[model samples]
Target: MVRRVMVDEEGVEMRVRINDMKEMVKEAVGNSGSSQESLEGLVKFILSR
Candidate 1:
């Protein structure tokens, strides 16, 4: 696992790391997520061209 730090320079600070695959997948499939929507748009544009 990789180590990371999340610092709220104006408030608080904490150590965190993204070690959850399921959480990542859930976010990647969210209804209006940028990554998913952008990918779909890209495919559609390619097909239309």
Candidate 2:
């Protein structure tokens, strides 16, 4: 997951972006990342059986 979703933005804008962190984390856990990809693969393996 990205550490900073935005850089050099207004506080309001940054705060607004911060609100999406939950969704971002969900996506990351959904295998939208390398680390999560490995975990997801494991989950798939189990589900495949």
Candidate 3:
């Protein structure tokens, strides 16, 4: 539940979770990352069509 997850009241847990997500996103978009590869593949496919 939302109440259970945010029990700290100061939102420390929420901030930590957000920061973790941000790090993951940065990695996913970094050089040779899966997301970057996937985007390149999609662009190639669209261009070929």
Candidate 4:
């Protein structure tokens, strides 16, 4: 896998994959993201205990 990516000078597929992953990470951490909501829920539950 590493050798294949290194040989591809253009890095087209890798670039696209990296970009998509970045977008997904951004969305997961956004204000109204699922990850944010889960964290908030966990905090509330802990406080209620």
Candidate 5:
């Protein structure tokens, strides 16, 4: 299934992007940045999916 989802390098890149965005949100929350709102929005989005 993993192989099927990641058929090419572009798929790998997209996965990396998602991971990076998740990490950024974690850092923002830890540093008490204004990203809190955005992070919450992201969480809601993921949950809605």
Candidate 6:
């Protein structure tokens, strides 16, 4: 399972890794993207887990 926690960043800022994953998914859904299959595999893994 994914564990998410909030941490004080000295007022700098913070972000979730899922945002990066979504960006990767967007690229995968693009034309002829190499990550297209990878995105599917990741989704399966997450669901199975």
| Predicted model with the maximum lDDT | 4
Root-mean-square deviation of every model = 7.1, 8.1, 3.7, 2.5, 9.7, 10.2
Residue 21 lDDT, candidate 2, scale 0-100:
86
lDDT of 3 by residue, 1-49 (tens): 6665577655777778889999999989998888999999999999999
Error of 2 at 3 (Å): 21
- List, residue by residue over 1-49, the lDDT tens digit for candidate 6: 1232354553223355666777887887886677777777789999998
Report every candidate's CA lDDT: 0.62, 0.72, 0.86, 0.87, 0.81, 0.65
Model 3 ranges off by over 4 Å: 1-10
**What residue pairs are clashing in model 4?**
none
Which scores higher on lDDT, 2 or 6? 2
Question: Candidate 6 — worst ten consecutive residues by lDDT sum?
Answer: 1-10
Return the TM-score for each candidate structure: 0.41, 0.35, 0.65, 0.76, 0.46, 0.36
Question: What is candidate 1's lDDT per residue for 1-49, written digit by digit as tens?
Answer: 1232333542223222234655677788887776789899999999999
Decide which is better by lDDT, 2 or 4.
4
Clashing pairs in 2: none
TM-score for predicted model 2 compared with the true structure? 0.35
Model 4 segments beyond 4 Å from truth? 1-10
Winner of 1 and 2 under TM-score: 1
**Candidate 5 structure quality by residue, lDDT tens digits, 1-49:** 6774589777888888999999887877775666776788889999999
lDDT of 4 by residue, 1-49 (tens): 6766666755768878989999999999999898999999999999999
Model 1: lDDT equals 0.62
For 1-49, candidate 2 gives per-residue lDDT tens digits of 1334444346557777777986787777775676698888899999999
User: Could you tally the backbone clashes for each prediction?
Assistant: 0, 0, 0, 0, 0, 0
Candidate 1, 21: how far from true, in Å? 13
Task: Give the range of the ten consecutive residues with the poorest summed lDDT in model 4.
Answer: 3-12
TM-score leader: 4
Q: Which residue segments of model 6 deviate by more than 4 Å?
A: 1-15, 35-49
TM-score of 4: 0.76
